[model samples]
Target: MQENERLARTFEEKRPRLHAVAHRMLGSSDEAEDAVQEAWIRLHRSDTDSVENLDGWLTTVVGRVCLDILRARSRREEFFEEHADPSAGPRSQEGADPEQAAMLADSVGLALMVVLDTLDPDERLAFVLHDTFAVPFADIASIIGRSPAATRQLASRARRRVHGASPLPDLRRQHKIVDAFLTAARNGEFERLLTLLAPDAAMRADDTAVRIGAAPLTQGARDVASVFSGGAEAARIALVDGSVGAVWQSKVRPIVVFRFTLEDGRITAIDLVAEPERLRELDVVVLDG
Candidate 1:
């Protein structure tokens, strides 16, 4: 086989696995795809004859690209809040099927990502690659330029932070909890739903123009459930990635998104977002229709 053809076959075999790794590392599927494409460009440009362990090499390149993208996004989210108007930008926040496009919203859980955001880019990369996806510490070290032992330590630190932020709820149970919460919410069983929530619970949506408070924050789950329960008819529910949630659709406008939060088995928070902005950076049409 020709060298390029051989390289292409190897690249194709490894690409999907690498994309999953990158997606978990960076929290955006769109960004993950970009990183993988960039990795292919780098791979083909290099002299393929000398490269060994093409899978590892390609994964490393993709990991680096994801890291760079994370760093750039972090800076934008930090320094450019004033200029961060997604509504006015070229991207249109038009049609979004919340269940389909929100990778972070559906899988990572809001609390995990918020803590992950605090990690330095390399630490976040090392931790997510090793712990979240089970990439070996040695391979992770190769990607991050650290010794395997040091990479292990980095991962440990990040794990502690994630665990401290939110105890790792069994993902399966969490999914079940989401379904129950959504049912309770849509049915307006506010009192029954209160039993499912931790006394102090929180709800936050990123598309909003202002920030809201954290938990211990509410005593009455009934009151909290009112936000979502009463409007159940306008929304549609779907189980995306094992969690039950809803999207508000209307013929005249784009979709509005909501993600439910469950704690101690009760529906405690519902993050309601109707802002036409932030939906665009998310690269999803807000499918209200």
Candidate 2:
């Protein structure tokens, strides 16, 4: 078999697996596709015959490519710079793919991603490989330029951080809390709004949202309630990035989106976003009343 043909066939066979690895590492389907494509490009240019473990070789390349991409965007571990909210609803947010959205959120939980953001590049790589994918420390060591023992240590530390980060609440309870919070907000039930919020709950708006008169941030249950309670009259429940949330529409187009994170059946954080670009990417479907 010709070298090119052999390489093409082998890569095609492994594409799905490689894409899965990339998706977990990068947490964005588009970026995962890019990382996988970059690996194929690297394989295409290299000596295919010399590589004995093709899967391992490709995995290493994808990991490196993803690391580079993460560094460029985040500069340092810190939430991978959410250019677009990872939870921007689902591709079929308003459809029957409720399970699909749930899986997406579970696969790339916003709270979990926020924790992962704090990890240094090498640590994130090691953890995702060893803990998430069960890649041996010996194999991951080469990619991160660390000894196997060091890679193991890296993964351990990252795992510890993850354990201590925000715990996700039951999705069903979370959805109900979101519904009640919005309802209270629309009704101007100030005290009721507080009951549904965490004492330290926060609300933040992206730059685009801020540009349109939204505050950049609000902290504390009282403050957030002050901002949210008696507002959101136009908002309707929808799955924002797989989580049941709210979005405001005009003429059948979304003007802004509300994303929430809950813990213990109380609202913990809320995000207000009006970026048209992000809004376009988010899966938005009005829930049946």
Model 1 agreement with the true structure over 153-249: per-residue lDDT tens digits: 9989887877776454444455456556656766878765666666655656553423422232334555555554644665554332234455555
- In order, candidate lDDTs are 0.63, 0.76
lDDT score, candidate 2, position 284: 62
- Each prediction's TM-score versus the true structure: 0.56, 0.57
Q: Give the TM-score of candidate 2.
A: 0.57
TM-score winner: 2
What is the per-residue lDDT of model 2 for residues 94-177, given as tens digits with 9 covering 90 to 100? 323334334345666645554676787788999998887788889899888889999999999999998976665455555567
Clashes of 1: 14
Per-candidate RMSD, Å: 8.6, 10.1
